[model samples]
Target: MAVVTRTEPPPRPPRRRRLLYRLRVLRHDPTAALGLILVVLLAYLVVAPLFAVLSDAFRLQYGDEVHAGQQPGEWTGYYLWRVFRSQISRLLFWEPLVNTLVVAVGTTLFALALGGGMAWLVTRTNVPGRRWLAGALVVPYMLPSWTFSLAWLTLFKNERAAGQAGFLQAQGIRTPDWLAYGPLPIVITLGLHYYPFVLLLVGNALRRIDVQLEDSARILGAPRRTVVRRIVIPLMLPALSSAVLLVVGRVLGTFGTPYVLGLPADYRVLSTGLFQSIRDRSTGVASVLATVIVIIGIVIVFTDMRLMREQRRFVTVGGKGAMDRVSDLRRWRWPACALGMAVFAVSVLVPVLTLLLSTVTRIPLNLSTFTLDFWIAEELPGAVGFPHGVLRGPELWEAAWNSLRIVGLASLICAVAGLLVGYVVVRGTAPRIAAFLRQVSFLPYLIPGIAFAAASLSLFAVARGPVPALYGTTFLLILVMAVTHLPYSSRSGIAAMMQLGREPEEAAQIAGASWWQRMRRIIFPIQKGALVTGIVLPFISGLKELSIVVMLTTTGTQLLTTLSIGLVDYGYTQLANGVVLMIALLSFTMTYLTQRLTRSSLASGLGG
Candidate 1:
């Protein structure tokens, strides 16, 4: 037996040696190695910036040191005291927190009511033009979220805020404070922009529900209401909950709608408050507000996870023949169709028409005020940034090219990286590494875009170790855009990869193929559709993105979004509206062409 113990295999290798051995294992199976690399990279990109934000929250920031009676860079509790306990705490924190909750809750409720009804009508009822309605209703979401807010301001803006009176005021109608700006308009604007999320989610879930369950309940003499209350509602809870979480998350992080609508009424939400803090160079206060938003987002995500875990045992799908039975509305069919059309018109056509009308009219909503100066005039003497019409200026084309170059490249990187993350998560052998990569990549989605921008500014504003100062650089803009929009691409990748089998890669391996070779020759071809969807969605989103780019873009690196905001700042309303319309057209065209080329739909991407 040779002493029977064999000296325990030389006491095993040390921990370091074991790690090296694991690294060496990549020669045979590289998935774990790749997963670990992604985990580390994402941790640095996502978690490091957040750490910088948290550190700023506690440190004595510049300009704040004078107020706090502390030296800059010193540790202090002054920010906490000012934000939570001082006399202005209510104005700074409590009021904004309360308003944030009000807006978030209100928007969630309104969106649910509108979206749930539309989803039910489109997916469950025999509503005429269901096909068209389903496609048309999602167009609002495809546009920028703040488009509605801009349109609202165009129609109802009073002289309370700045610039000039809106169309209604110009027409001699007096718009009340509460109606013109505050929770009412903010809620409506957000609801219209975000309802498509609910519609898509609930509609998909509804389509998947086994109609046999309802049929059986009906055959058992259960009344329609009883069956709905007991079975249908319970089955739809998961989808509804998901939609609510999405709406709530969006509302929490939204800056443009609330800022545009809430400013005049002095209705400050958390995001706008954070924006003000940043703009005022109150880095400490901004950090604290950003931290609060991140915590709230974490709570929402955890709550959703808990609910999902509890509902894991409830299976809506079963081993039975299921069919989509369209409910016969007979006499109500035309009314239902009209209702669907009304939703589409309000959500899509109205805001767009409002903006279009504004761009052509010197005074919005005035037919006699129409002109083409904003679109094609060679020169405008008094214009600041745009001395010529928007289409005639080099600025518009430059910004558009920057947008296409920066966002296109970022989206491409995001798509490829997302697919790799999916591959590692689904096919990797190390469970912990896979889990870390998945979670860290999604961390950016939880943080508000403004907060992430703040973090990026803090982290990369100067050189840190190997990474040189990236502030005011195109690289920084691309990096932030890719990281912020990564969630969409990663989700699409994960869903697609989970459905893919390992057999193809295994066969390639049997033929002595390397990991890169297998991915290029086999996996890439299989997941190409998902790759395109991942890229296109982010491109559309980044094209209209304002919040993240607003903070990161400099004069030299201006994007379409920043240009539009600049025009608005300069009071060039018509030029601003023209740029926004261009963005909408670009986004819509890309979405349409991508769907046509790939034969995949936005619903599929979103539902996944």
Candidate 2:
């Protein structure tokens, strides 16, 4: 017995035992297993495409053998030189880069001022119609950002681009090219479109700032300006910085507004420049541009994170709830209300009304020329190839159906996947796997939509291993939309789950409920509101998405966005406006219905 005991294996070391215990737990725990699977899937879907794009930038692309004097797939830095150092680099990359930086910085500043001012008015002041202004101001975000560009064109188009003269030009007021098409209009339109990002973020931050802090500063005999400068702004630095980063990141990637407003003036940003390269089949250059955009986006994201960490010292919120004190602007209340209404006029009412007017009349804002021809006429005059009104055309109806079907299915997939991801992130036993899944799911948001679409094309255009090529299929469109929009649903899911306790699942487990049963009966039912918000948010976003769709859609897989852009390319302004209105209507209807059903809103969902 002594000899047998002596020969027995020694007890495992403490660290090794802990590792073995973790392995056993992961093997047995269903949540841990699901987390592991999600990690692998997200890595493939999110990280692999990025790697593909980076590799393509450094490799000799097809037909570029002549240009690079190297074989395809071979490593070369020719694209780097062509985009950054070559003779044509000024036109191809440097100018676009400069223009992009200018527009992005300008848009960020403009959005900050407008949105921050509005947020302060509504959140911290006795501004008349605060509730109405709060909701109305967020409506612009629901419509496509390019909607503002279309409206801008309707009001200001000059003789630069060959088509219909804009309202101003038609009225014998010669709209300057600077006002009609270039950085000015681009910044104005984009800032208007994205200001809500700042509003929501800064509004939340303002609401959280303990009024006592500001009141204390005032009690200490600080002047109003000093109080704001010393207390309010420092407390607001995190939100301000976050909003700046968010707007800048969006401006960097937004393709439609720049394309519509900048193209006529040849004011190319990186996004439009990349689009041009892709259209030219300059794959290497496109890859390099896409890579650069992603790198810039990554830098922004990291900077945001770092600033957030550094600004933690400014936190003044405490365990006790603080009252929100409203500043009195007794005589200025009406003026503040008027200001809010003016913003609504510019950001929402004008754009919607302008697009509507453009669709119904050949000459926008000219009531005498009103007709239903663009919407319902059996045949459209002077519209060859697309001979029917948008309502009467097979193309419009088909594209609408495709958009609803593909985005619907994709949103459903996103909702379910997001819920599962949340479940794993919150309940899984494997911490490392959960964190990896969390991070990888968010990576898509960092990459510009066009770059992500390009990466997706590079990765899935051809088959690899057991996966078949998905180049021209509707499945690819659905897949890309799902991945690109996953962050919204995933964020909503995580936020919802954070408030959920584990008692229900634990009780169900004690009652002999299977993992699926617990999830289906316990988790799903409780998260219904979050699930709906997740689904509808992505549906709204993907329905109007153009940059991603433009890169992936072929003739067979055309979405409403691409359909509208194609009509624009064909110079069918009224019909394009009609399609755009249809998109806005659908998006608004979906968001309205979701909010009504779930008692949740775009602002709250996006904040999460």
Candidate 3:
């Protein structure tokens, strides 16, 4: 009847009908839009680079021109063949691959031994100094990998490659080649630095174990060791696997330790080899190496993920987990405490002390010879800006200020963007946007630090499109850092915002609170801790970072980490040590202050 009328209904309005359907779907499924958006963005960021890097790997190139023989932009397997299977692949890929596996396995074992024992001492035993041990155990994980690498070099560099006398030499000790450098030193250093990761994971798991399980096992006629083997070990497998994943990822992508300790001895792991290839402008080979690293990392991560995903329960019959009585070590308590302190002194304090001592000592990296003149004296004759005068020197201050400026700005950008990304992922009405935001947020996690830096360098090196000469800009550093740290920050923000819940915000909306007002009052205040962690974690991590910023800058924009690295290159071990110490101190200060504040806020938030 209506259609028969002169003003017939507008042609069924298909477009408007479809639009209305989508809106109805969105109303039915609000959070999914956000999830889809996050997933897409994350997929592009993580997977795009792999494709781009892979494409770069296959396409033949020499300077601006593609090679004459092959099709201009056609894909080829030349890179894979040349890097992985050629006669020279041994030097470029095979040996390095072997070295990486060896170091990784060795480090894994060492870390488990150290961390498991420490966990046992604190969790299951009346080990003296357990209170103090917990704090010290996490120190290594907190510091950057290279800090320990540099510390190892400062303490053990022999007269072979650099011929730089180290701390041992200063005390009239002739360290063997093995002690100074090689796979042994590399693995030990990496292990010591990473064991704390395992300690935390394993300790947390162990502490949460229900004592009643063991008691039940005992009641079932199971012996102590049997109870542990059948029950505890199985329970802890998930946490242990997670720890293994972390340490493996850490060692696999690391460039600094391998570079610092292995390179001088002609030892080439994947990172050092990849770095060398890039340095030689062998981008094809570097890409191949990076691809290899990525593949290995992905495999390990997926394995860990698969294991984690399949697990039904981390706890059995969850209760307020009982605290098991500590095993009395009898007379071994005091001695055990002493040993723990000694290890702490050497592992944590010694490296820091060495750096401070070296900074004061004029010889810098070559610590065998010492001079207070570097600290007290105004200037050295040939040194560019050195002697203790340089401590107060404008260049040093400028470098410090520049680092803070870039790092601060980068962290701020990351924090804000991360918060938005989190909110969108958690609260957006669009499914695609949600997935995209999540995927993009997780990209930096998959990329190796150096590779990511190189990626930035590659894309931005050429002045094209909207990017104008970002290759040397400090803004580039800020952008790169923010991007690199985005994955973690954004994740933290999302997790925080998720806990804010929909009810309160919904209530606010029904009460007619504006969007901004609801966000300012209800959402932000409730989830501030996670936001703080996002900011603080990135800021602290950026402070100790060298590998990312190293490939992206010149001496003019050198970071403290870069300076420590350069001091190594220049054979100024002591001054390098000082720079390292300063960086560590800065990190420690920030960590303590932020942790205190976080604790305070959480207490306040809960109390309120």
Candidate 4:
């Protein structure tokens, strides 16, 4: 009887007891606790601001009180009406909407054609320079997208802009309006910058294709075109769509390129228009436009996700017999090599050389006018407040330091949080929680940078509960940078962690090592390369980030990207180009060093 009484399993432990048990277990288990905390934080940081943007779109804002005839903070459709139906709606919304679509479509097509071709050449064909060309083609992306715009302007700027004539125009070759500014240049520059994205995605997809499929078709007397059409094109469609969506999404949020190129022609896209609204203190208008961008971006992201799901259907599973066969180019080998090198020249060498040439000389490609003044002189003619050269002055150094410190800190945070998130995702017992954490962490990637920045500005511009108002502070920049760039590190972390077995961690745990001890001694030591890559990739991205931080940065908190933009605003072309060169060089050097250290390129982490 006593055994029967005790053997009832203590009345099956009350629900409260079971709940408390879980809580206690979670408290002891760092992964569960960390997962919970990250889910909450990422939801707040990544998802909350999107609601803030939508909220601001309908709710009356401070300056809109006069226009809406409603008190601030009150609900109204006036802002929506103004953006969609009012007199200036076309100018403020419709035209920019059209321009954004046009540019996005144009850029996507151009990027796909160029990137798809290059990917084929490098991965499938017997291209001579494939070894170096593969790495070199990714360089344009490391530099800022606007670097192309700067070069384009340096070479093609017309009298449409008030100040100095471009080199072509300076030599009495007046470039056409379309060549100098507006959608065409925006498309080309963005295409050049983003084609690497396509190359990475499609190229990886191409590499993964099983050559035996094609060989089998060929051995069966199928034509090469038939093999490509049936075997290759069908499999590549998903990657092609993904590349297109990525390019289009980037075009939607990109500010610097469109702003620099579009302004001269009075051409405006949604990003530049949103920026204008923010600058003009048209909060409601900005919120509306930002909401639209976010909506489009979310749609694109969902479509991409769907395509990715469908992509699994096409996965080429292979055994040890699988081999990637490179097609012999025969007499076309030299031509293919020449084409690859030519692309490298146009995309990497040309931009770098163009910026370098512009920095030292007022006139492009002119040796006589070359001077060290832009780099080291204490004073220069017509350069108003920025009297000293970029190299000689405290401004450039301070900005560089801030870029390193703020971006470095942000990236470090990203790396650590990403690693923790990966652990929680890969090793956690609670599937739902882990899945939620993964999705929430990645939500920021789908939100356009400009829209996210606007959302952040709207939500955190004022005090919200425990978090203080962070509008113009350096902390705000760090927070946004970390949150926006979290996807890269998180993906890298998850990929790295999936490959790491639990034996070491389990052994450490069995030896009575605490969770932190296990992570520090076991997990981190094994994932050092991934950790470094996580830090460096985000660092490079945030360093070159313009659209996101541009909205967040105030006069006191200028990053190199913003500082270069500021110089551009002041018409200090040489100094601005000098700063641009610095950014490109720094970005390239960091990427190169990270590749050397990790034995991996930026493309590895970016494959996600």
Tens-digit per-residue lDDT, 1-608, candidate 4 = 35545344445788999999987665446687787888888888888898988898889988767877999999999988999999999999999999999999999999998999998888878777686778888888998999999988888988778555788987889999988998899999999999999999999888888888888999999998999899999989999989988888988999999988998799999999999999998888899999999889999999999999998889887643454677889999999899888988998888788889887776775778888888999888777768889998789988998999999999999998898888889999899998898888888998999999999999999898998999989998998999998888888889999999988877877787877787778889899877888898899888899999998887788889999988888777777888998898898888888778878765552222
Residue 283 Cα positional deviation in candidate 4, in Å, after optimal superposition: 1.0
Q: Candidate 3's C-alpha lDDT?
A: 0.75
* Model 2 agreement with the true structure over 1-608: per-residue lDDT tens digits: 45544477887789988988988655435786687788888888889988988898999988989878899999999999998899999999999999999999989989999999988888888888787788888998999888899889888988888667789988899998888989999999999999999999998888878888877888989998998898888888998999999898988888999998888899999999998998898888998999999999999988998998987798775533454668889999999899999999989998889989988887878999988888888987677868888998689888998999999999998998888898888887678887887888888989889889888888897898999999889998888899898988888888889999989888987887777788789889999988887788889898999988888888888889989888877777777788899999999998898788877665662221
Give lDDT tens digits, candidate 1, residues 449-505. 877888888788778899899989999999999999898888888989999998988
Total clashes for model 1: 0
Candidate-wise lDDT, in order: 0.86, 0.87, 0.75, 0.87
In model 2, where do residues sit more than 4 Å from their true spots?
1-29, 317-322, 603-608
Each prediction's TM-score against the native?
Answer: 0.91, 0.92, 0.87, 0.92
Pairs that clash in candidate 4: none
Better candidate number, 2 or 3, judged by lDDT = 2
For candidate 4, the lDDT comes to 0.87
Better of 3 and 4 by TM-score: 4
